[model samples]
Target: MQELTTLKLIERISTLLRAEQRKKYSALGLQPVHIQTLDYLASCNRFSDTPAAVTDYLGLTKGTVSQTLQVLERKGYLEKQQDAADKRSVHLKILAPGQKLLKSITPFDVFIKAEQAIANKQFDSITAALYEALVALQNVNGTSSFGQCKNCITFSEENDHYYCLLMQQPLDQADIEKICREFISVTNSGLV
Candidate 1:
């Protein structure tokens, strides 16, 4: 039998996880894209909560994302607020119901079992390896890293304040932990 490559293994794991996610969310009457949008909104900062960012992150058409957002809003899963500074832009905020739905639909049983089955060090190593692999793939595809602000090359902490050099904006702790569509991977930066 041919041995599985690392890429093949990663693909298999992704497929399995997605299958589990589908099974879990199907019971809640949500499709994968809807749940993915909710998950993204839950983890994204204010700067990344716009429909354009969602479209870019999901690699979906504007119409598709618009429909998804409408459905989510109608279901009371999210709300759209007009940006105070730019009426043309709108922000998507996941509601309490969406948060509750996310909590209920998280497919962590398999991952939890895998963690329990592996040593802490082994799990850490595996996670790091997977992250490295993901980075490589993203680089190859020239795709957005969608990493947390703290992991971006432009992130800085000075005078007890967090800031993003790229966006030229101050970041709070919450923003630092949230994902950004414009994230430039620090690992890919030219720093040793």
Candidate 2:
């Protein structure tokens, strides 16, 4: 059987999910990436690091990250500070309003509502089974196992699980421990 390329799958999913995200978050004048970025900052152990730190962690270009930061800052979602160790570097912290926004219409909540509606409307066991098949394929590709929860895009220390904000899936600690190059120190909730 021919393989379904990763790019093909990602393209298809992104096309659908992006539209959904726009319909929801666009009301708040936010793009899906904006939500992703804010949520990423809120969940970070040390978001008060240089902008380069965020770009590197997200595998995004510095220019793109800088542009997004500007938009976020203008919207009153973030505040920046000069790095103490490096005067030239700037760090970011999500403002209280930003944190509240993230905690409210989270991607997880969206997925749960959609999933519940789909389960209620039709025979969707096939869709569920196909997702299982996709997982099998991912495992075969040697890219499916959890490794490093701390570096995951959806990991939340408050929840203590690798919760994917995009997929809304909860990955076990062992499953995410392997892919955590961007791991930072875990901060207590009281600190925030």
Candidate 3:
């Protein structure tokens, strides 16, 4: 019998994950795209929360993002606030309802079995390997990694204060944990 390629195994896993998410979304009367948008909003930093950023990250058209955002706003899941520093730019902030909904919908039920079955050491190793592979793919594709601020090339920690040279701003704990659209790989930046 022929062995399965690594790509096939990865695709199968992704398929199952999406199938499970679809089931959940169906039951909750939600579209996968809407839930996905909400999820991204929940995990993304301020720098990545605008409609333009969402469109870029989701690889969707501006009109599509605009329409979906309108639906989400009508559903009271999020709010659009004009940027204080930039009037032309708007920010999307997930409200309490969206946060609560995401909490209930997430934890990705499809991974429960695998997550429970994996040994801690093996899990860590696999996670690290997958992340490395993802980074390589993103590099080849010329796409932003959308990684945590702490992992970005411009991130700097000085005397317990976190700062981003690219943004010219200080980062709080939340900002450091949230994904940033401007993220650049530390190694790729030739700084490490």
Better of 1 and 3 by lDDT: 1
1-192 in candidate 3: lDDT tens per residue? 112335643654565557667788889777788998999998899899999899998999999999899988998999999999999999999999999999898776435544543324332344454454445444443555666788787989999999999989999989988778798876456564
- Residue-level lDDT of model 2, residues 1-192, one tens digit each, is 112345544553454457667878889888877777887787677643467777877788988888889999999989898878878877788898888888788654444543553454443354443333333333333233232455444566555645655456676767554444232222111121
In candidate 2, stretches whose alpha carbon ends up further than 4 angstroms from where it belongs are 1-11, 108-110, 114-192
Error of 3 at 48 (Å): 1.6
Q: Model 1 Cα displacement at 47 (Å)?
A: 1.4
lDDT top scorer: 1
Whole-model alpha-carbon lDDT for candidate 1: 0.77
Model 1, 1-192: lDDT tens digits are: 112346654874575567667777778788899999999999999999999999999999999999999999999999999999999989999999999998876756656555443334332355465655555445543556667788788989998899999999999999988778888876566463
- Candidate 1, residue 3: lDDT: 26
- Show model 1 residue runs off by greater than 4 Å: 120-192
Query: What TM-score, over all chains together, does every model reach?
Result: 0.60, 0.53, 0.59
Task: Return the top candidate by TM-score.
Answer: 1
Worst 10 residues of 2 by lDDT: 183-192
| lDDT of model number 2 | 0.59
